[model samples]
Target: MTAADDSTFLNISLPTGTPKAERVAFLRLCTALATASLDPADAIDRNLWFAEAGLGDLYNKPTLAAAANTLIDLVEQGWTLSTAYKHGPLLAPPPSNADPVVEKARVRRQEHLRRDPQLRKASVRRFVEGMEKPREFKGKLVTVFNLMRDGRELADSLTTAPDPGSVIRPYIQIVDGSRCERTGYLLHDIWRYFRHTWSNAYSTVPGRSMPILIRDAATPHHAVIGLAAISSPVVQIAERDEWIGWGTDTFLEEVRKAPSDEIAAWLAGRIDAQLGEIYLEDLLADNVLQPTDLHHPTNEAIAMLRADAERHRQKHHRTPLSEVRQIEQDPWVQRATSHLFRSKRAAMLADTLEASRTLRPFFSPKPAADGLCQALSDTKAKVQLRRLIRRARGERVGTVIADLTVCGAVAPYNALAAGKLVGALAVSPKVIAAYRAKYSRPSDIASSMAGRPIERESRLSFISTTSLYGSGSSQYNRLRWPAAVMGGPNDKWISFTELGRSRSFGTSHFTDETVDALVRLSRVKGAVVRVNSVFGEGVSPRLRKVRLGLAALGWPSSELLKHGRERIVYGIKLVENLRDYSLGIDPAPEYLLDPEQADETSVGVWWFERWGQRRAVQPAVLESMRRHRLVRPISHGARVPLPTDETDTTPTESMFFSADSS
Candidate 1:
């Protein structure tokens, strides 16, 4: 950490116009910081705090450079920022009123106030006071609201309790959002409310979702013992992608040596003839396209695109992105896009197209292992067969591969580690069947673009989720079922595979108000806010808007977006070959669970034997369950108390500050 020994990290070049005195002072400060043990986010915050107090000048390029150098050094030494930090100073303003981050926060507050003025708040308060009389919960003898039976009748079960594993029958029921039956959407929303309320990080995004209710038949009225849901998987996840081998894997390896006519016809059929031209027009005109938009274009295609995009930027001298319908109708662009694919990759792509045909364009900081070798490595041959494979990976991201939005047991069941049981059922046959039924309908976006309902076979092949708190989820650790029982290969197992942690990059930490203010500020700064709230515009529009705003404020969006905490990611495969089945290369998925014999019932039996019985035998589990008697405070394990005198929702200031937020 000393200057003599740590010169590599401490070596920094100040700005051209930086005074000699300031450079010397900054280097001295940098030397002190280099030895200090601090996280990247903490260092940035402390530096900014000092700068605001006239102790440092972090605004200037020279000071920022020094700080960055120090940060890079700390990062190399195994220091990191928590990605879950919400009020990070990196993206937001410092405490100083003059700071841009502070100003943006002020603007966000102002905008929120302006949108819903104090007058409106006062009016609503007055109206509420005048309209309704204050009421309290009274002993309800006539109007009873509960899913459980009479307390007296239930209380006896604890004293003369039967073996929970033998009597308690657990089963999974698919919750359809549209159904009006008793065991339908209402229960799902109720479960979601409890789920989000208890877990600070749990959230549901736009797009596809499937809510499943786990019920215990032994309990009165088939009461909800646990809840789980499946939602659309994100298009890009670095750790998940690398594990799936999106780049090293090949999509058309067998067809590589096929006849030119045969290959051409197959490629032509795979191409979206209707949406291809229109999408390509949007791709060239606008910013760098989302890789999911293209169908794994070849090395030649990507090169042509970068060249064309650069040309458009220079010629237009303004906005390049166009999602408008007008461009789709452009005759010349239409003609150009029609031949763009065939002339570039489709024509030249064959067995002969080897490592020599390298991609000149840069996708990331480090080049991928896309057919590169040392034998002919003298040239700058950067082949990008990754895109084609990546495209295959993305095909099922929206449909076939669903992420668990919420998966865990409720109170009494959780006492016996029933959460593990829920995790086990996540990959059961019933879930797969339910997913197929829910998403088999025509895609609205695809249907509209093609002028007809496009019915594609959308079935669940994989189920994935991230740990809620830390580096891994305890409920899923060593959780597996014998593949032979589930009708899979005997050598393999149907278990959750560790897919590495996420890179901890997102805009979740930024409050809605912060994002709104940033978007407003971006507009004032003459920055084109591309997130138009339009469907199919992009994933996580709020995040996109926030990134643009951060950039407008002269900050690196990529760096600031990384708040630092990364959660462990896990994936469960229902099909034999997840990559191939997901890419539509395999016509029918080789599901792990048998169609006729193996089902949710089998899963229930396994859960009882696998985890439930073993847990119930533990003295701690029995003692915990004993406390959940009829008269005991409800939902204690979930950190929830009902609308009663015991319910303490009001915080006493100690929660927010060292003393009080006073």
Candidate 2:
């Protein structure tokens, strides 16, 4: 056998107890005789077999001699050519009475059973019916529709246009949670339809969402055209924060400072008011203070003040002071008590001074007091306070954009371009005010008044939305809409891969099939090889050389590596990413429609195009790749090389590179 053939056999796992030298020699001899059209029984001459197998020089070697002696022993033991030459014992006894005709009939029967038309039709029908029916989703009754309905509604709405200023002009209204039982149900139905028909996967609408319903104003019943569900903004998004000129530092600082100020002010005010209402003279007059009392009148007054402070703390959810002097000279306290207790006519001036002295040390350091107050405050209250403060600071702190988690127009309305109107109304001051008002109530006045009032007019800065890539009906990307034309810079803000990784805050819909395909592909070839260098031997050098060769061969370096990790030690360049060299074109929807059908090359091309790489590799680096067996030569007219260990054999018309002459 040639070195290549020997290498191939050696790669296979050998059976246990098989002597390595004897097994190699036996396989080589059999392979050589088989290739030379000579029976193994006639090739017992070791020299002739060795020469044919291209191992003549090793004939006299100890390993070969042992193998020859083993073969002689096996022959003497009555082993025949057929039985002795076989690699392993039969896994199962040969089939009895084997018949090609019967086997063919059985295979045909299995194929027919697998392709049963009735079964296939029943399954498809069941799926379509399930998609058509209304079902409870996310704790609400939601209606569903298929893509056919989506396309039909869009066509009808486009052909019919309502007159401008007509009562039929579309308008968006906030769904009032308290009174929107019917509206909420309708919204869920619309969302279910959108999700079932348009979204790649289903996700429950987030809690505390404000559902906006778009309706035709001119229509007598205000026919619903679209639906949008807005939810709380993500706490942090690098792109959004950078765009709004708010860095991580500024955001953290403001969040920390605002709550601290509010807590401190509130505590100081409560303490001052409670202390002012109590007077030492009044306590003495009530006969609560006696001349012979063990506690001084001033001490009794301080005790009464402390008790009052505790009651105030419990009532307002403030932290009770472990020490009494914490709020003695608080600015808010001094301001509140100055006129009532520190006036020239005050009868208990000495006692009040003593009380202030007792309180000074406790409130001297605001940080300790702030920490105590924060710990004692209700968690919900603190969060609400922070949100209010963030709103009040406006664009300086960060832009408040409505996170449109679910935004899509209904059948006829969506077709007529009503989604843009909904998008516009989402950020409109009037709509925002209505949405705020619907949730606001007299009962919430106390809580609302606790935070500094935010100006609603300038609070909202923008609106953000996302859609699947290549989706033609994405409203966010539709340029003709007034909202799109009036909006700020429009670009692909985030990629699906990034969104998929961040489950907590990102909005991406990855179907089960896509995820499974990705996992399977990753297992086969997506995993990167770790190159741990021991005594300077590592795969990194080979990889680097391969990269250089590809670059020298006109392959783009930016497209060489893909985003994936293996064992967290090596960054793997996927075979899929190699499509950039094989097919230098962007991927089309048909190419990526089914991930299961996607091979490494097609996936790499799709990923490359999806990321929009513009950089190209320098020719100087191509030499390195050539030396590392990373790339192989192909035919003159072929863009992709034939099936080799280095390249995929799957033929494609979209090949990028011509076969290298060298």
Candidate 3:
């Protein structure tokens, strides 16, 4: 199975010769067969499974054998074994055909449902329960409890003659977290049932979150036009990070270089805070400490350290600071450092300063800034200024910006492009204010872990979302707002510009049950699981679990974690200087938009005139509304979309890697 003397994956061929596409396809076909649960000794079952999965058309027995041989060739040529999925659709990647996005979603759904049978039933059950007390108004379904007092014209207004804005006043409402009866429940219901084709399990969403409903600002029955859930943005987006320069080598270098003397003086003044972050980093680099020892020494962290020290003792090594094996766990570990430890710590700090960005995650801003502050004669102003300037890399990005995770209009409103309205209004001042208020308090988990209230700033910088499909988007396309109206300078504006394609690597393709198993397996393996779903620990906890879990299962982390299904990344900068602000260079963020200058009412009016009215006048829209009124069994536009093929789909909520993901 080894490659011929000079063969590589791209250059390998059948004896008769094969093109590059054909070779990749062969490798892809080989990869699919290899991952399947067929008997390794039996070509029959492998070929059968490949055919059944619809990947056999381009492959046959001899070609499939050749594919396997080519795979061996690849392995010989240093092709990673675990990322076999990357070679091609492991099993039925989207075919080049009409509605490929929908088709691909169908494949994903089929795989999920195949893994978990109850997902669809549960989704339908919850959806039906939400409509348990349905009240039909014409053909469209309605319920008393679900009704908003928004001024969306009912029935007759479906074919309304006037500009819909005058008769139908639209506004945005932040879902009241304290109450789940109206906006909250409706938001969840609509998002779970309406927007996506792959999955819509909103309960899976995590981190500090804000839910918003685009509603008609009317009394007695405000119709819910759309819903959006804003939470923490994904911390690692290559394109977005490249755009903002967060934690990038160049940005961190510039910041460090700008404060040239301060950086040097800080490294010299206090090598380690009483916390021993520096000592821990030195030990960690030398395989002497675990990541758990980074912060305050909790009982669990101490337990890990003790276990490791015990192992070291077993190996006849009396490591310095090993006395902590018997020390009662405390908030901070007080170490009487040896000259060796001190010199090693100093060397590590020197290396860290030399390559700050490369090793930024392991170091904390506080210890370094403390040292700098002390070196600069620690006065209140100097300390505060140093703290402000030396804010950690991930902290601001985690709290200051949010993602428009679950966003879209229901069917009836969707027909009017109200989803676009939802997109525009999602980034409105209402969302910003709501986010600020909701997360302004000290974080619960963070406070508990640190043994103090960790008050984090909730200054919302901008909102970002990804298109459902990788190919393109229709909803947030050209979704723009004038900055002048938003209290910014006349020349500026706001809009969700397509940032770029997000990394087509994630665990969304894996089912929840599958991920749960992977996590369990990962925990059993002992080293793959890192972030403990702890607040302020890291971004994308679920992503961490799934990816690490895969490694626990002995799969290639990056290759299998990769779905290769890229979604469009879109973002808007609420602040004039998102990059500088994210880097902590700007002491105060200059907001490009303000809540006072214009509210949801104004955004809705713009939506109404700009898109809704025009869409309403279309004969097609009128006919659709008329049909909606006549249908016996009312759907009410909350009908969930499925991959058109309707193959046994996984629970069709939103397989979008979820909200906090983006």
Candidate 4:
């Protein structure tokens, strides 16, 4: 007490109860600062290291100025100095309440490298370094970049923190490109820095030297491993909002826009793939920070679980899920777990089925529920059938089939329709019976349809028997019809089911007419004729049923309704081999053929058939051809004869036949 009291009285040893470790750390930092104080050349590392120690709270006075002051103090204290000059005193003083000791340490450290020649040389060296030569891959970095951007936009358009996986899976193509991979590499570097700096505070091994989560040191391997280095471990453990909301579109766009190179393209693809994988994890997150219905059953189930968790949380602040389940019987949750493909049964069964040869990988694979898989298979079969019919009819399905099939993509129509049908079958016994009768084997049908008359005598029975409108409404849009009815592989095709209805239906009654039409059809028996309008302005109603003969079928007042008068145009040009001469004109094999050209409408039932087929094709050739055509028509052009330039020596064969056919 005597020594301490005397020291305190002399103000040499203030009232210091701070931990020994902290004091040691501070002294070490001071020593480092002192060592670099006189020389401005060593300041960057000196101050940067000090700041890294969590003294950012000090060295203010416009940072550089504070560093200059720190340098001056260290110099006065007779500390070793480097060959550099101090930058300057900070223009503004640090906060009045800031700790002077910390401030002094930071100021001193920062001043060490204020004018170091080596630092300048290092910076210049980096600028002068040459980058690796560019490479080429299957797809362009720009395209993938565009896809990411589009995917992000699509995801953000949804109400929830979109089903992260679905956000990228549908739009991003995993073709050969380095854009995504490079991005991953960049992310790796960034995280490496963070990890290295972080470890200094907590771990013995330097962060940079330590392996990332996956432990693979190989660059390509590291690039492929998505979870190796997330933004922050805390965010990951807490499931931070940023993690939930991590979309790489903006970052990817930059990658895409980078100079066209193989490395860039490949990296882009890798990054996209990684993003897609992360998205899937996010989709599987229990609590969807941004909830979206546009996700697969597994994702939806996860979101539902999250919602249930939130509900439980609201009810019993911070109660664990296990205990909360004991409090209430949750059927919605149970059913979701069972049918939504996240349940243990679904996972096991799906994995088995996927491994088996009986099921198609795209239509039926791991983690898919039996019912869902069957529905997906049926939808896929129907799509294949439609495509076959379309190809037979003459449609041009894009080359996205390989992508869609391998990735297990279901057309919006397929999802919507199958979902609608499945819902209906689950809820309506008649619909189930009808589907069984129509699709099941005869023996099975005979066993299942025992005793009941083949034909039922009610509208509900008929609809149930037909399996037209499924039981549950869509999760995305309740008022709108299921996408299945429209029958296309794209969202655009699905829109047909709604008759070009605007998305702003909830805002006005105009769309109510469309809903009314659907409702009328649902309620009315047999063929009913109802004239509906978009504006809800025209509604002519008449109650009448017409019978054609004594035992003839009958029709209700509703007409066989047609869609609105919107005409989509398609133009066709015909090319034919013109040859064989008889009498007069022996053309130089090619001539002006404008009159032989014809423009025709691309309408009718066969239009879809002509354009809805897919084939394995290289995109590079298609793109090149397109560009070539844009510059100059790939097909030959006709040469017109001019009276002035003609030598009047046109060859006229003795037995030339009529060659031009219009």
Quote each prediction's TM-score. 0.61, 0.30, 0.62, 0.15
Model 4: residue 586 alpha-carbon error in angstroms? 99
User: Candidates 1 and 4: which is better by lDDT?
Assistant: 1
lDDT against the true structure, per candidate, is 0.50, 0.33, 0.52, 0.23
Find the candidate with the highest TM-score and give its number. 3
Q: Residue 617: error of model 3 in Å?
A: 1.9
Candidate 3: C-alpha lDDT = 0.52
Root-mean-square deviation (CA) per prediction: 12.3, 27.3, 12.0, 34.2
What lDDT tens digits, residue by residue, belong to model 2 across residues 1-662?
12312211211112344456655655666444334433322214445655665544443343333333333222221222232224421111112124545433332232222222222244433443443344554564432221112222222232343522232345555655332233234444444433333322334442235776665444333445566766645444544443332343444344455545544443333334323433334334544444343123365544554454344333322223222233233343232222222221122233333433443333455524454345335454344333323422321221224456666554433433445555544444344455445434321111122221223221233334443221123354322211112221242121111111111211021112222333332223323322121111112333343333323222232332211111001010111212111111112111111212212222223222322121112222222222322122222110111122233234233322221111
Candidate 1's displacement at residue 625, Å, is 2.9
Worst 10 residues of 1 by lDDT: 653-662
Candidate 1 Cα misplacement greater than 4 A, ranges: 1-163, 178-185, 248-269, 272-386, 484-492, 595-599, 628-635, 638-662
Give lDDT for model 2: 0.33
Q: Worst ten-residue run, lDDT, model 4? A: 398-407
Candidate 3 weakest ten by summed lDDT: 653-662
Top candidate (lDDT): 3
Instruction: Tell how far residue 533 is off in model 4, in angstroms.
Output: 82
